[model samples]
Target: MKPRSTGTANGCEWTSGTSPLLTIRGLCKSYGTNRVLDGVSLTVRPGRIVGLIGENGAGKSTLVKCILGLVPHDGGTIDRRATVAAIHQELSLAGGLSVTANLFLGRERRTRLGTLDHRTMQREAAAIFARLGVEIDPRAEVESLSVAQMQWVAIARALSAEARLLILDEPTALLNRDESTKLFTVLRALRGRGHAMLFISHKLDEVAALCDELIVLRDGVVVSSGTERLEPEEMARRMVGRELEALYPPRAVPQAGTVLRLEGAFGGSFELHVGEILGVAGLAGQGQADLGETLAGFRPLRSGGLTVQGRPVRFRSPRMARAAGIGYLAADRLRDGIWRDFTVAEHVGLGDLPRYTRRGHVQHAAIRSATERFIDTFQIRCRGPAALVGELSGGNQQKVSMAKVLGAEPQVVVFNEPTQGVDVGARQEIYSFIARLAARGVAVLLVSSDMQELIGLCRRVLVMRAGRIAGCVEEDPITEESLIYLATGVHGT
Candidate 1:
């Protein structure tokens, strides 16, 4: 049977008369008592993009895992007729490996003498990057690259495999608008070439813009699936089973008191007032990472003095930053933020161990009680506080990260990409949570690549270019155009 065609992808017309590349029937998976996927079924056809969307803990990851054979399903059948590859939500590249080595990791080229062929691999790696229209050095180590560049590397690696069926999970979460547009162009090109893709993202607008079909999953079941195009609002409603509120909460007024101050640090100086959310924005790799790291105490400030609540202090570590009433929400939830092996209770209580501790001996009951409270307050979906953090979904993990930061009662917070991989419903919740923080007089420094996030939540945004403060925009209603022009140095109407 021919695949059903629906919406246009970018400018590419939907492909018709194509056979199914992959199919599943009655797919079910269970982790002990938790039913992650229940009777899920879907079809991916060649020359089309299928958008898989859902809320956190909605079995999207489990379905992907079962399809990739990373996990075994309880009862199901997944039929695959084409070569498959998956771009993970979390980066899966070897950090210590070079770009060239990572691209040719398992599928290595060797000379007739059975030795590794370095020249051919490097040449092919460069060619792949060129094909993707990204400028990346093949010799550079993956760990040395910035997060956006690393995401490009991951995409290039996936394309290098030349798989016909590609599964991408939250692929554009770390990418800025320009970068995302470029990537979408590339995906459109791939679709034109008859490659099938299962695109999983929490960004509803992206799903609407790029997919030929929409599949909505909630609570481990497919609630909506069709060939017709679904609007963002309809998709959000289906994913959460209710009418969704605005993605961003109403802004609060900032109090007139400087809560945190940095002078000449990382090529800029700024003061954060009480109850104010100051945004840091720019094209990727424009010193925003360094600024966030410095504020969070991961890196030392260079050529500047840091002050908190009128007290000059230097923080060489996170502990020192926390002691000085500062908290940080890292962009990379897997690496710098949450501990996968730690229990929810342990991770939440980690921010303020003293509250749950009594004279050096840890208080387990107190920790569990506090974590349970957070789970309820934040609406985190999991079995209990004792559940491993790794078992939680991406959005829930992010919620836990926010809980950990806010639970410490810090006067200032550095939130980097606070809603990177969260779904629409959870995004609203998080926006409200941050707004409440601002209402309570907490100073927030929001470092984000998502422009809407900066526009929606920040009172003043500092746009960076080439590791310096390029411009600052403080419009009553910030426009994406102003931020883009400042970020790219493009002077135009």
Candidate 2:
């Protein structure tokens, strides 16, 4: 069947002069009883950056998937005049392969004999790297590259495809301010070259600055679409279906009680204090991941002392850290968070099995009850506990990851970009959850490149520069300007 187009009267059109380069109309999709996309419609004109904003489960990803022919939409029409390229939230690069190999894997330049062209691919890969304003060794393995570098490589590969329409989903999540600015510069250059882009991001300020038009989705439907002239607050209200009084909740004054502390912490070179949510911010290469890994026991600290409740603690491994009442949630959920092949029940129950299992055997009934409780509590959209984690949406997958950590009941919860690709509503929910965790006296340490996320969720923000604590600011002093000043090493109040 021909897919139905979603660019009907219900759709938002930025231009009235001519037809768009790509048009979507009546896009409807569902998984059993769960209707993900309900007649969602949109349009993207040539040489325009179209911003797609929505709450979690608002059908943004589903719409993109349908356009990419990954998920078969129940009813939709996607009309396109040119080839489409997408940079998904999940890194699509093969981890085992080298950077150059992944970039030209399927679309490699070949000889008449149909063999792989190695020299040509490497040379072209280096040029692509140069174009992106970064110097990455083409021969280096993908596994060795940092998350931000890997993300750049993915974008370079997409650009190399010479696509007319490029879709970037949360492309700046892992990048620091400098790196992100460079990326924006590249994107603007692309826009100048008449490349139509569908930019999906949770950063409202970025959407306002970059996009020529805005399309907002809510509950799997197109609620608002217009020229990029609306106020950020207005745009957020439309996406979330409510007015937000304050983006960040009021920070509670830290009491004198001991929570968690690090004495002369020498992971690389930094010291962490109790009752502080240190905001580790830098240009992804500046040792943020290294610090997080060290804190989580994934990497060894050269010579450091970690303490909780005024007692010296030793965490040699992640298991040891968990045993010490410290929980670490990795930024890459697909790799370290959830077991994708496992069922939802299995995923949620994996961390809390000891609590449910009394004797040597496991308690299936107890596990089911616990999973159901988490699903209801978190408002997780899924078929059932029996459904595989891989089958769920990105938002739902993140919820599963959170459920696993929350089930463990740790004293200190270190969240590494908890809401990287999550939509607006899910972000709000996650923030609320984090606040509750703090209210319950669980020391929350968040490492996020997102300024708004750090400002909103954290009480006291410590800016990390070049693998050390540059400066610290309380909530009263926490503003975008101040955070950027510390992050970029500028002087400000």
Candidate 3:
């Protein structure tokens, strides 16, 4: 790839003239008493990639919705060319459709007779997969694909639309490191072709590496925007209106007691220690899910003994696991963690509703107070406790998931990709919260494909390979290179 030339003459990158490919002025959006976006404005020049950074509920999704015409904004002036395509964070593909069919759903290529060009669609989709470094079959059903592959199909759909300006929202949430790097390479090639991109991601390092300009939003408004190089810490501080004192707080030594234990914990083979933040690290689909499910009783353990506080426990169901002081935060928050139609208060108050009930009747005031405390503590942005969980942003929804488990005051917490799809500010907040949990004597088992999240949050990192523990390293000695060696069966130093 040739080195990109910085903006010519006017100190703006990627443009020789004044006209921008996309421009917005005085954008405002509100739903009842909650204002999502307020007077937000931005400009994207052709051939430039702009990174959008903000906390959950800071209006990132709302702004994207307004641009895509998915939602109506109260006030705004958006000037843009006609060709635009967006890959939302959520999977928007129809589950029943095949990959090739979904790629050209509404904008199918037509013959002279107006018939759908099925052959052309299949051939083009194969070429796209080769370019994307993915191995997805064109005839595969959308529901049959993994989440990462589904995201790639969404990208292919956007490219098939011949969009001049492509918007990608948290595109790497479900992808592993190798997959994400490959996607970045594709984006770099597209940038060279003068296609404008609005890249929204929570990973600060990715923004620094890929984006030519930075736009930071907070509380539904653009707090800062310019052609400047801002460090991740500075960017995070601006987005959250405060300095993050520590990414991960110091961990206290565990007390000399066995809170929980798994002996010969062989769904396959491994043992989990109690009172330690056991970091489970591996590539996607490397049997971590099997181990986690087996531990939580979601998957049957063919051979193993799980003891809590020195008493034998048999967890035949999720409820039984929770009854034995164990809580699991699932990876698929939308499917397993939350009921979309349920209100935030109702979700949080679950499992512990008896505390807020008066003589067998639910107390509205008590439930409201409990929900408000979680909102303030977790910084959950919503209309109110009564706001539906589905209405919240991805990060806020994850917060509700965490709140649900913590509200039960469980002795052990297992988090699977806890910070997936969350922004930089929210990531730091979650790291701090998890650290606090460990300090308060709550044993945490963190399962993640992101090595950084593991090394940052775990006290003892356990590397898993082929359904077994490859090695264990104290946090002080862990590094990205060392972790990768263990993950890939390369023998760590």
The deviation in Å at residue 387 for candidate 3 is: 3.0
Judge candidate 1 at residue 61 and give its lDDT. Answer: 87
Worst 10 residues of 3 by lDDT: 1-10
Residue range 238-328, candidate 2, lDDT tens digits: 9889886566665544445766666565323333344445566654555666667776778776666767667777767888777777788
Query: How big is the positional error of residue 374 in model 2, measured in Å on the Cα after superposition?
Result: 2.6
lDDT for every model? 0.86, 0.77, 0.80
- Candidates 1 and 2, the one with greater TM-score: 1
Show where candidate 1 strays beyond 4 Å.
1-17, 119-162, 266-268
Tell me each candidate's TM-score: 0.90, 0.86, 0.89
The whole-model C-alpha lDDT of candidate 1 against the native structure comes to 0.86
Clash count of each predicted structure: 0, 12, 1
Give the Cα RMSD of candidate 2.
Answer: 5.1
Model 1 earns a TM-score of: 0.90
Instruction: Please name the candidate that would achieve the greatest TM-score relative to the true structure.
Output: 1
lDDT of 2: 0.77
- Between candidates 2 and 3, which one is better according to lDDT? 3
Best by lDDT: 1
